[model samples]
Target: MTERSNQSVRRAFKLVDELAENGPRGVSELADQLDMPVSTVHDYLQALIATGYVTKDESAYKTTTRFLEVGHRQCHRLEVFKAVRDELETVAEETGEHATLLIEEDDQAVIVAVQEGPDAINLFAYPGARMPLHATAPGKAMLAHMPTERVTDIIDRHGLVEVTPQTVTDPDVLFDQLEDVRSQGYAIDVGERIAGMVCIAAPILDKNDRIRGAICVCGPRSRLDEDRRSEIADVAQRAANVTQVNLDYV
Candidate 1:
């Protein structure tokens, strides 16, 4: 945790980021793009290689397969999503809405799985779809449980553009909403991200009780207004708990 060590790691990460976007590159190319000394870049690259985060091929350095494997493991080993599939199906069968799972990646919420509810309504989410962290219900639920530094970084990168009349575009308000989510144990999007769509979501906690992912139910706004929001929240929370229990076995 020393300043010097942190700086070195940061520099190494920057080099990796450059290589990631620019494809494989030689030490000189990385140094030039990062504006760091060639020797320094080489040292960091070597360190990355040692940690299996990067691999050197003759003259070019690229990200290692290990990083890919690690990401893959994290995605699949997500306990909450794994645990709640059957329950989500049941919830969908009973409610006839769409049930979904979302996970945070690079400060954005990505849909990992979805189940169609019995109501037979059309919905926007599917696996691999990305949504703004500040706009979607699952996005806000995940963000509400993340570290402040991580949340601030995302806000700094992607400004809170108003996606709908209900979207909170102010950071202060978003922060306050996060607090409310923490207290209430879930988040609701009543047509905040998409017009005429209502979403209710709850955080999926891991074995460590950390926010690992989120489970949600979505349907037409007409069916999930303020009067029925509590009912939707109840379903979401139950599904989330089921997902958490599943993660324990995984």
Candidate 2:
């Protein structure tokens, strides 16, 4: 695409982001935020509204539900699932724990695969489940690698809602944890989203080094204490790497 076309698209996306975060706003406000002509912003807003990606409030505009549908469709379109399904089953078999495949959707994590071990456990989420980007291991593993501006925007859009006692509700604390996860190349969720459950997750990267998804293993907190945490991390990381390799991921 031409540079001018790319710039226009970026400006349109920026307007969408602003509308999503700040609610409905006038075309003049949008143009000010995006530093574009008022007519240009109005044109973009009208196009987005026509596509059902945005909704008009008389002269103002805001995001519509279509963005969520778009995100869901995009989540399934990623070829990462071809490698994740069988690997999750294998991980569940080997670890005797729940295994899940989570893909990053904007700033959220959606579970695309969930495999249960032979022994029953009502612990993990099912396929098609959505979770916050900062609460779960798989979610954090993906977020930890995102660009700083993107991460900040996600935090601004959705502040950490405390799901459990272990949940990091403070943005600063969560930022520190994300940095640590990036340094370690993985993330751990110790009953953060649900009590008595622990998860270990590693990022799955594509050939371009972009994180596509995460592979995670979930077990009872008793089974994943400090003694076995490292082992669990190793197993989860290896499984994730194997899936990435099968997809010719970097």
Measured by TM-score, the strongest candidate is 1
TM-score (C-alpha) between model 2 and the true structure: 0.68
- Candidate 1, 116-199: lDDT as tens digits: 976858775656677898998888898988899989999999899898999999999999999999999989877898888888
Clashing pairs in 1: 96-118, 96-119
C-alpha RMSD of each candidate structure in angstroms:
6.8, 8.4
Candidates in order have lDDT scores of 0.83, 0.83
Candidate 1 versus the native: TM-score?
0.68
Q: Where is model 2 more than 4 Å wrong at Cα?
A: 1-76
Q: Each prediction's TM-score against the native?
A: 0.68, 0.68
Off by over 4 Å in 1: 1-78
Q: What lDDT score is found at residue 17 in candidate 1?
A: 78
